[model samples]
Target: MTSLNPRLGLFRDQHVVRLAAILALLLIFFAIVKPKNFFGLATWQSMAIQFPEFGLMALGVMLAMVIGGIDLSVVGIANMTAIGSALLMLQIAPVGSDASTGYLALAAAIGLSLVIGALAGALNGILVAKVRIPAILVTLGTFELFTGIAVIVSGGKPTSGLPPQYAEVMASRLFGVIPMPLIIFIIGAVLVGLLMYKSAFGTKLYMLGSNETAAQFSGLKTTSLIIRTYMISGVLASLAGLVMLANYNSAKADYGSTYTLLAVLIVVLGGVNPNGGSGRLSGVILAVVVLQVLSSLLNTFPNISNFYRPLIWGGVLLLVIVVNQWGKNNNLARLFRWKGNAS
Candidate 1:
């Protein structure tokens, strides 16, 4: 019994650990419920392909949320970048271009799209930081603004007909099975992890979110940090846009509209404190996998419609919030004389 307690303690020590156990149980449950479907390679492949798009967006959301902010503009920024990239590629290589020319156009389009994303993010940063507006309000307005710009640019239609190269390379797997977007997401995760774990900026971000007043009094440049943080979110959203554009071969002003709320749900489920100043990139990544797998597993059942997924996501978010609220102070821990007593 004592040995079992120590092993159980390992699972209870961290939110990620607990979530991982839940994920493991969920996989096992799905496997038991539908042994044939759950074990199929196609199901796993589809889940892997879908994970990165939402995962990347959720990471952006996590960053903003960590600093006690929310970015409603991520969807808009993603669509706008996608629209811009498609339009640029069309002008550069057109539909009938040779493969080499198409690849060149693709390269140029990627660079231009990233720049557009950065500029858009910079606009978001300026509005939130220098303009002295709340992050929520600023991003909310930019959300519509960017989305509108995408629509106007695309004439309220999908931007398509990119160089053939774009589709070919995007579809091509790294080792003939792993999707390119998954690789991109891995690279992105490494970069984001370094940004958060190895820099003074990350420290300042946490401090600012923990207590802006104290950060200001400590001579930290709070406004600049806020701007930088939003910029990262904007850029990440743009990367997500690229992924969508590549996958669909078309960019629509309203593409992945579901992602906005879904990203929030992922961040919340990843154990990011909505109030701010605490979150783990690793947790968000794990959350992405769990949610994606759950989605795929649920998808195996014909009775569950796509419409209900959002409802389930919202319910999970509410449940987590309620659980956290109930146990946050952990009065019961003190009553039971737990080892780690609250200071």
Candidate 2:
């Protein structure tokens, strides 16, 4: 058994290997196609800037997925939170105001956004856990509900008149080249990774996902963990929304509508089991980086129309699904054969 353990470890860890392979492939492809652009610090910085919000959204989705659930409402929540921040900023610091006042207004806007996000998440959690509705149905309902509120509040118009400081903070370089958004993303990933991987609550989440009945039988608080997972997702989505507002210097009701599919793609591409119970943050981080690099590559190639991006993304998703199924089947076959031999 000990002799076979190392071989089993290799198979168990194949997801990690695949993630690294994808990243390496992306780097090689970018280097070949856009040598000059791909190697520049400016290009790297731009890629870093593009990641934070999408990464955060992906993180939220990953957490829900790990708990054997999904949150289709994250994009809607982000959009609504972004609009809420914009509206609050406008109310507190009209068209013109002193920089200090603008800063305070921004702070207030963030607080309001967080509160709104938490409420939305809580509602979704209650519907799923207490009301005994499937997460898919609950989140899908809120997706539309939140987006509707966002459109009504923004009047289908882009928000402007943001204070200059917002842009300065978003675009600022720390230590000469690190963008503020990238720094925020790193911090978020580290903190959330620790919470999900190192804490007792995280273990409970995995146990619930693996088998809710067993977790409950073992005296785990499954319902509370599920609710808390969604709540955390909501908070992270709201934070992403704020970053988007600051980075773009404008907000729109539909700002995050396109991110819904992207977030799911990242989670799946990261090798997270769709049926849940097993995954890692490292794979997710690599997947996000790979996708961002792919986006950058596509952006550099002017001839590759933006309309085709979705098609490419869809194809990649299909491939990932196929690969996951194949891996699972192979593992199951091996496990059964081993059991038969032991018998």
Runs of candidate 2 with Cα error greater than 4 angstroms are: 1-12, 331-343
Instruction: For residue 73, give model 2's deviation from the true position in Å.
Output: 1.0
Would you list the C-alpha lDDT of every candidate in the order shown? 0.82, 0.82
lDDT of each residue in 1-343, candidate 2, tens digit only? 1111122354356666887887899899899988999889889989888888889989988888887889889888988998988888888887778888788887888788888888888888888888989999999999999889988989989988887666766568898789888888898898887886568877777777777889999998787888888888898888888888878888887885668888888998887777768777777888899889989988998898988877888888898887677566487578778999999
Query: Candidate 2: deviation at residue 49, Å?
Result: 0.9
Cα lDDT of candidate 2 equals 0.82
TM-scores of the models, in the given order? 0.91, 0.91
RMSD (CA, Å), each prediction = 5.7, 4.9
RMSD of 2: 4.9
Model 1: residue 283 alpha-carbon error in angstroms: 1.1
Which whole-number lDDT from 0 to 100 does residue 254 have in model 2? 82
Model 1, span 125-186: residue lDDT tens: 88877888888898889999999999999999988877878878875677777888888789
